[model samples]
Target: MLDLRVFENRELAQRILMAITREAEMIGREVRLMHVCGTHEDTVTRSGIRSLLPENIKIVSGPGCPVCITPVEDIVKMQEIMRKAREEGEEIILTTFGDMYKIPTPRGSFSDLKGEGYDIRIVYSIYDTYKLARENPDKLVVHFSPGFETTTAPAAGMLEAVAAEGMENFKIYSVHRLTPPAVEALVKQGTNFDGLIDPGHVSTIIGVKGWEYITTEYGVPQVIAGFEPVDFLMGVLLLLRMIRKGETRIENEYTRAVRYEGNLKAQELIGRFFEVRDAKWRALGVIPTSGLELREEWKELDIRNIYRVGVPKLPDLEKGCLCGAVLRGLALPTDCKLFGKECTPRHPVGPCMVSYEGTCSIFYKYGALF
Candidate 1:
């Protein structure tokens, strides 16, 4: 039988934490490291790593959760597509990952649309949408492609597959945002986090070199980290070392998956079909070249064109919603009055509480509200 003790290596964890603490103290400065991955935030909070760290060492959560950053307008636009198709007496199938179903918009969610007699299916992969398109050529199958670089690779591959097969029924409503531009926007806004623990999965596709501009221009150190406790601790250690030595560079702690240059074929596929454009994040307003749109060459495959629809402009939220501040790292979940009591995960008034990777969801799951 496998020993459980192997997984519960508390002594090693303590040593790593102590080493980071010691190194941070030697520098005579507070080490404020921002983790740019929601999974890392959840892991650190659940493991009580924040309590274990020195008082001077702080970890702030960045805009790493894709769902939290997705603008309300995109959700509104998706609902409009569904409503339009139903009025024309045509079958419109909306497919996306399960997490997106519960994400609320100014109108409602895919779940709400499904309740109103819309054919919205929760698909595990984009390939599933392609298969459905092949089987039901008569129906309009629109896949909601809302994600960052980590998911864009597979979504790009699916587009390629659809193109190769010449499937006209399948369409992708893309709200895919890139990572490097978002990070650059944060830096340009004069945000003052000392270092960044870059996203591991995103780094796997875009690589460590993707953050070169942040280091060269903003003089901030970045380390791509894995999801493990040791990996996070080591990332902190490396960032502290960089700050102490007065060096700003990009490092990859999760070297197993990421390299200096990422997957070339995946990048090529994304370049072939998508072009960068200004996008409005839910919290952060419009950031130039932060979003990906389907290229003009592939306009025929674009759902927005086929449906003759455009993304709508949504007004600000109702009172007592600080989702924008939270996503910008200006506030935490606990800072909001409606965090735990009024805005629990079960009945989320904001998008941050709806998705599993959201900061509010992380706090709710790990009992951080109290």
Candidate 2:
């Protein structure tokens, strides 16, 4: 375990809050800050950090939760693909992380499909899927991979390993995305947030320098941050400092883990197996080059290509489901009419309620403050 002592001290936290309060007061305007990671949302909310922020300073959730942002149409498309494979007399096993298994779609969840004996398996990581593929060579193993750059790296690495070893039976259905393009979309759409409290896990993979364009183009400051309560407070303080000075640049509050160039080895692995393509965001729609796809050289390993299924068309949002607004930072979890009434963590109607790191789930657990 990490012995990061200063971060845990209540006195230090109080002092940081004071500094943030001072900064917010000096600015004397509504300071809109967006934290673009689900883990960060959990930290800010679960720790009651949002409740502690100055009334004038609002911290909002962004396009962070991977599962929450996974378009319902994509989930539906995967369900159809798995069903089709079964109908075609192919013994197939669909593997994905646990968070994805319960994300509802028009066709219900993969869990529902599993209950019907469709062979949906929840694996911890891509490597585990690889092992499963190896053990059951008789069945077609389709790994349903999803997440941001950090999770994408390992999935890509596994695909590379499959290519090297010629694992013909293994394929990947990639829902992995890059964070930069999403940030750009928010800026282009005029989010008007004072600064970004960036995700540390994503920054650890893509590095601090990857966010340079957001500052250069949008004049918005971003502070890379860790998952701890103290890390979040420090990130906000750094942002406040930037906003007060009328500066727009990338700052690294998560210095202990994030580096200038990020994890090059992971980048290399990602580059080797995947390429940037125009991919869909559930709420944001298609942001050009925001999503990752298998390279042409490895197209045979793409589940879409192998199954002759095109990119799923985006569907209309469920009636009264404010998940779209929530993901875009346009609204809060409590703002949705269905939040606590029709939707809860136990019986989630939307993807946002299903994932542990999702804003709706976080808010449901911690209650909304802003």
Candidate 3:
């Protein structure tokens, strides 16, 4: 059996830290590295990895959190559905991840709607939403699916199962998106990060090969890393080494779970039910081929088709919320004026402070040491 303790070994962490220092010193310039994973940020901040690293070496965050990237328009659409349901005296049950429940939209949050006697619920999985649909045949159950590749696979599997059964009461509002396009958009928009620490969880589904475009196209190297401190440090080391060597390629540090080709079965399952299209991200606007839509065959279960919901012409973010800059690697969570005082977990001013995977939330939970 593998010893889980090995990853957290203090002595090993020191050795990695020393190597990082040496690499950063050899690089002899300001090296800005960005990791597109909220868990990576948590590990970096919680482990005080930044405090240990050379001052010249900076680690920034990208648009990694699925909840952070989920467009406010999607929430508005759900709100419209709820309003129409109540007006028409229809029982419409809306289900989504717990993090999404507290996200503030122009029409307030799902929690607010629930308080007003709406059938909005916090579900752990698509399976839970399915169970709710099965139990309540009279109500229209809508699963507000929002995630990257990691969560999309399971949602696709559930969609397949639901379609096979021809479940009429069940519907899905898919805000599922692809990570690569968003990453590419950052590069195109000039975020100014040297290397990337690719998200380990997302890479497990999209595969190590999924990040090759970053190197081949933008000439930026990336390393796929796990959640552990050692894994994150090692990823930084590998990326720095690659940069020092003047090489651009995608490296995998989390090999135990991720593969070159990725989970083919999961990919196939997703392809059958969803198609790639331009998607509207919370901060990034619309990115081509970044969002997933249900295939024509599966359109019968798509909420967007059955229900017409108008998202108000509103700013993507709330007043004084710096989540957009934070997600784009242009600013840190601490840079936000509303980070600590006005925006705590209890009261979130933006989606970034709401999701566990959001950079702002991670930084709030684990104070930035650097």
Candidate 4:
């Protein structure tokens, strides 16, 4: 078992924060570090770390929430696929994590679609879909696979399993996005940030080598960080020191799990079952080679082909919603005209307020929507 005492106590966190604040003051320059993990955003807000930081240091939330970035068009397409199956008198089940149920689309949401007589089931994992496929051979089980590298390895493993067992009724709606390309896009957009606090879980899969481009090409310092408060503060301090010295490099603070080369077996599995393709994010549109598509050998399991469904286009968000700007880091959640007035977490007008890890939701929960 992992050592709980080291990270459970708050003393280590306090010490790290003190060091970071001291280093920030010595630099005599504003240090802005962006964290690309939603969980880290929650940790920072929940622990009140922002209030503790020096005035010269700023921590901004990046486009890290998977649910927030899921394009509305994709959700609408999945809903349409379910509707088409029902009209043809075929039994179809759409399974996904419970967090994805409330993510809104242009028309409505999966919850709304389920309320309109669609079979949308919530399963814990892809293996559960295989079990459901075995129980009901007559029904088609399409799992909505949405996540970063942390969750893609298991989905890749499940695909290999389904292929070995020759399960024709089971398939996955692939909406998986990679981390490196998204970071590259953020940098190319010329976001005025000094450094990046890289995603630790994703780094465990893709490794530190994948982030070399950010430092070499984009000239931004990045540090892979863990979820704990001490780990995060240390990462911040490292980035600040690097910026102070005018150095840009890829550093890994979470050395226990992440390595230079990462997990090759997982990478091989992903390459075997899927190929890189262009995908649309709700806020950031059509990033090149950011998404994964199923391989041609597994075309038989493609839900779009099996059900003969057409992908539909969705309209842009209603006016006065700054979710797009917030995701792009051009604006904060409080900058929205309807942030706390019309777009509370209870009645979110966009995906940003729907997910718990979303920046707007985080701010709303901690009363930071000033």
Candidate 5:
């Protein structure tokens, strides 16, 4: 096992900080870097990395949090499934990650519906959801699956398992998304980012090579970094060096876990069970080929295919919420007027405030570190 403490060394962090300061001075211009991982945001905020950085080096949060960026339309569809089930006097259980349970919609949240005797469940993994289906053979088990590559692979594995066993009780409502396309959307839409910090967890599944297209086509530099303070700081330093040298390529700082080719088995599993599709995000509209849906062969196990829940058309974010801008890296969480006041983790007005991985929630919890 890797000594996790080595990655958190204070001495190394200070050295990198000094190097980052020097690089910022050498560059002699403002640099904006965006990272698309919730854990990266937590590391940046909780470790006080932002406060320690030179004023010219700014880190922007991207649509890293799956729960935060999950379109409200998908949530409404899940609710619609429950509502329709209730109307027909059917007992169906809705399962999702804990982070996804409290995401608010116009019709309230899964937690709210759970309070009102809806069969909503918080599960840590797809296996737990599968277990629910096995335990209650009579009830329909619907998993509201939403995530990037890291979580999606396991869902595929479970689906394969379900198919092999001929299990019909469990179904998945796949809102799984792809990280590369969203990054492409940000680049294509002309988001002002100098460099990209590829997410460590997602890269572990997709591999470092998966993000090469961003640099190959857009001439943008990227670095895959872990969630540790040193890992992030090293990624920033690598990006700064690339930026200064006018180099456009990907560097792997989290090589201990991530690789150039990534986990082939996981990638194959994902491809086996899912197909690329255009999907909606909370703030960013429909990004082309940015989402995953179950393959036609496995459509029987898909919840969206099985249920005809009428999803009402709804706006991405609530009125006056800047989550859309935040996700696009156009604004900061603090820039929102309601960030600390009206929109909080306790009572989120927008999707960004609801999840711990959300930028607003991280800033609210650890902004005091600054």
Candidate 6:
């Protein structure tokens, strides 16, 4: 068990950093490790932990922010779903995370629709969405849910709740993604990351064994870790050790929250309500079975299947904005010309800037530390 006190100890933290630095020297080469969790990036940036790192160590952020990676086509599809429902005289309520509300689509943002008298509500959790459904039984409740295993598990559980309650008014347009397929896609593309600092939240839901494919097939090492600076440093050290050992395998450094089998109930709910499908990421494009769609039996509970919502032709993104590249770890936030100039947190020109978990947003807030 990873005690919380150990992580909070400044002296212990210093020792971990010292050992990590020495290990970096021992490896004696440039090391690229990608962490595909926005929360992990936030911890690294906010804690000024990157400044304590050795020179040759680089930690890159991958497709971690759910809102930043959602394809423009899906956003357009969301727009169409709400509009068509209103056109057909159906009262509808669209609920999603606030990040999704501000994310720019080809047409505009969901916030734009909100301004035009659309009934789009920003919800903090699926339970809040359920409450909305129960209260407005006459109105069709559309939940536009998106995230990795962490968020997906809850969405799955919500579906189970709906089925148990015999509720037919609620429907979901799931843009949920699985990280393994995205990671594998990275390997297939010959991405240069030598190892992975996997997301701890996702691992807690999917378990450590879910990542076996990374080492077994892609021949890459992965270490799951929590949000603390020590956990992340430990994960990096594990990766370097794997490199020195000339071995590729998946290991867990976040055992305090994660286990080998994960949350079996959450996994059961997910397996019951969802199936794997090809999902289009912003820059990485369509990854094979990387997305979760409602199961065939749950087709009636799926808005896309019920309404036949088609993808709309999206408008071109802002010229010279590299949010796509930034999400894929190919380019840093500073690489974009408009990052701090034309695009800031107040007025974001791209989706990456809109998401608090986004690399651009993190860089904009704390790039000076790096």
The candidate scoring highest on TM-score is 5
Model 5, span 7-124: residue lDDT tens: 8999999999999999999999999999999899999999988889999999998899999888888888888888888888887899998889999888788898899899888999
Candidate number of the best lDDT: 5
- Minimum summed lDDT over a 10-residue window in model 2 is located at 308-317
Residue lDDT tens for model 3, 274-357: 999998899789888999999998888998787776776667888999999999999999998899899988899988999998
Least accurate 10 contiguous residues by lDDT in model 5: 303-312
What overall lDDT goes with each candidate model?
0.83, 0.86, 0.89, 0.84, 0.91, 0.87
Kindly report the root-mean-square deviation of model 2 from the true structure over all alpha carbons.
1.7
Give candidate 1 regions above 4 Å deviation: 1-8, 310-312, 368-370
- Candidate 2 stretches with Cα past 4 Å from truth are 310-316, 368-370
Each candidate: RMSD to true structure?
2.4, 1.7, 1.3, 1.7, 1.1, 1.5
Candidate 3 wrong stretches, greater than 4 Å? 368-370
Model 2 residue 79 lDDT score: 80
* Residue 236 CA displacement from its true place in model 6, Å: 1.3
Candidate 5 residue spans exceeding 4 A from truth: none
Model 2 lDDT per residue over 234-304, tens place: 99999999999988888898889999999999999999888998988887788988988888888899888
Clashing pairs in 6: none
Better of 4 and 5 by TM-score: 5
- lDDT score at residue 128, model 6, on the 0-100 scale: 91
**Candidate 4 TM-score versus the reference:** 0.95
Clashes of each: 0, 0, 0, 0, 0, 0
